[model samples]
Each structure stands twice: as C-alpha cells, then as structure tokens.
Target: MNRRHFLKTGILGAGTILLGNTLSWAGEIKRDVPIFGPDTKTVGGKKHTPFIKAPKKVKAGEWFDVEVEVGHYHPHPNTKKHFIESISLWIDKLEVASAKFKPVQGAPKARFTIRINKPGKATLRAFGYCNIHGLWVSFPTEIEVV
Candidate 1:
C-alpha cells in the first residue's frame, strides 16, 4: 500500500490521523502536519482561535485561498454573549491579516487570500475567541505548494 492507504488504515479518524502524520501531540503545542513545527496556542489566555489552511505545495507566485470557520463544540452550544473576537491568517511568520465576526446563531466564517510569494514551504493557522466563556483555542490546517 501507499501513503493514502497507510493514512486511511493506520489512523482512527481525521484528528487522529492529523496528529499522527504531523508534529507530535505529546507536547504543549502540536500541528497536524509535518513541515511546520509546533503552533502557538494562546495569545494571552484571554482569546480563542484556530489556524487557517491553504495549498502547502504550490508554485511560486501562484494565487490561493483559505477559508476557516469556528463554532461552539459543546452539545448545548454557547450563549449569545459568546462570539469570535478575531481571525488571523499568516504565511510563515508574517502576520498577513485578520478579521472579526459578530455573534450569530451558527458558526463564524473567515476567509483569507494567499499567494505563494516566495516558494519552498508554508503553514496556516486559525485562532478563535469567545468572550462569554472566556476561552481561547487553536487548530492548524496544512497544505503544500509545489
């Protein structure tokens, strides 16, 4: 079998496969993919967030897009007072841009435009925030740019 087969059978689910394929989850921080190292979680322990994702292996100077959405994972759902404070997108270590969303009945949507400015490798992360619960969280989305 090849990589696809290995990934399909070797892991239990999406998150598990992600953790096993990428950076080790045994540390304080972890990324679901390899090329990128451990990701930063909390900004100051007052905000919640997650990382965005895009084509990791793309041609230099090519254009791409990354979309991220965040919502309450709790079975009861969060109260209306809770909402996403901001969403940030980055290429490598540069802070490309950020966005804010108002409280809604459903999940929050954030979009990011990306172009392989240089080449080689890249990483994307999304951060979410909820004021009511006062919690912060992060999830990493990975890709490749040829």
Candidate 2:
C-alpha cells in the first residue's frame, strides 16, 4: 500500500523489486545496514575493490578532488543483470554527496570536487551498491587539512 509497507513486505519476500532505476531489494533477507567486503576479492580473475582516491593533505580553503571507483583493480560488469547502482560520499558520519548510475549505460565510478574550510582531521568514506551483489563500503580514507 505505502512505500514503507511495500519495502517491508518486499524485504520479507523472495523477490527483488526495483525502487527506481538506481536501487533494488534483494529478497526478504536483511543483512547489516551497510555491507562491505574485503579490500580485494578474486571474482572471475578480477579484483572488485571499492577504492577511494583523494589527497592525503589539503589546504583548509582549497578545493580538492575525490574519486570513488568500484572494481578499480578489477572490472565489474556493466550489463543488464549486474552493475553498480549508486555511489555515495560521506565525511565522518555526515553524508556529503551521492551519484547514481543506470545499468548498461553507466560505470561504477564518481568524481567529486569539494572544499573544506576547517583545518583538522577528516574521515572520508564511500558506499556503493551492486544490482545483484547488494551493498559494499570502502575502507576509510583519512585526510588532513592544514
């Protein structure tokens, strides 16, 4: 009837319902809130690691680039059945931005240019979801602003 109700029901069912062009529910089974895997996995001879590329140090008021890529070491399929759905960027526990992709027409990568005006230690993290493999998160990337 409602979205929450639908999601709740869908999560309990053995089928996945597409939530848009970007998200889906995989059966009625629930795992941890955010699912992540090891740094490297040998799937089909390719390494599927959620890699975050950013500067180790930055100026307080300067703009810098941050790139979030899935299967950086290995290549993930970009087909109708298996592909990355979305990639999100987070600073500490605060979500800063997100990007979504369409299967067969999109790659599992996103680039962000951001400016932080405070000098301190900042924890950067990334989250991505695959159509068939569910969710995956990156190991934290810590940056220093001076």
Candidate 3:
C-alpha cells in the first residue's frame, strides 16, 4: 500500500475509536444522573433521598443556614462497601454548595449559609450520591424571601 493511503487509514481508525469511546462515556453519564421518587414513603427513597432544612420565610440579602442531610428519616449505611459519597445543595436550579464525605468517616450532610438578593419564591433541593445506590435527589422545598 502507498504511504499516504496507510496514513489516511490509520487516522480514520483512530478517529472512529475515539468517537465510539466518547459515545460510550456519554451513555454512562446519562445512567449516572440523579434520580428521585415522588415521596419518601418507600425504604429505598428514605435511605437515599436528601432532606433539606430551612426557614419558611427569610429576608432578602440576609444569610441563613441551610442544612442538607442524607437519609433524614432512615439512616444510611456508613460502611466501606455501601456509603454516602457526596451531598449538594441547589437553589432554584443553581448549584450553590456541595460537600464530599469519605466512607466510614464522614457523614453525608452539609450546612450552607446562603442568601438571595431578589425578593421572590425560592426553591431548594438537595442531591445525595451513594457508592452503591448511585445518585438520589430530594423533594423541592420552597421558601419565600420577603
């Protein structure tokens, strides 16, 4: 075969392999996205879902404490095999804070002091990730900023 033809074939093969790997990685990300149920009545939901604690009303521009705890009702496992990995807090579709925990040492909980500058309704949500159970999201908690 000619040198030019061989080089062209090699480049095309490398591109195809990279493209296939990219597609496979994207599929894995889609499957790893956070999931949640409508409520926490089930055992799996209670163990994996994150619960948010905040005030019902707050003044604009004032910082307040927001607590996010994974498995508020039912405690999740803290062993090396199955444990909570991280916790994140989101306000109105924007991620404000996050915390990471080591297995068997740190708990999946965080406190974020945040404030909104605008006066309107704000929605707060928490996301929790487990080593075994993947990701889980909490129900939205709405607060009014006067």
Candidate that scores best on lDDT: 3
lDDT-superior candidate, 1 or 3: 3
Off by over 4 Å in 2: 1-34, 41-48
* TM-score winner: 3
The per-residue C-alpha lDDT of model 1 at residue 47 equals 26
For model 1, where is the 10-residue window of minimal lDDT? 33-42
Order of candidate numbers by TM-score, starting with the best: 3, 2, 1
- Over 40-86, each residue of candidate 3 has an lDDT whose tens digit, in order, gives 77676688879899999999999999999997978999998788999
- Prediction 3 global C-alpha lDDT: 0.75
Taking the tens digit of each residue's C-alpha lDDT, what string does model 2 give over 10-71? 54232222212112322222444434343453462133447899999999989899999987
C-alpha lDDT values of all predictions: 0.48, 0.70, 0.75
Pairs clashing within candidate 3: none
What are the RMSDs of all candidates, in order? 13.2, 8.3, 12.1
lDDT of 1: 0.48
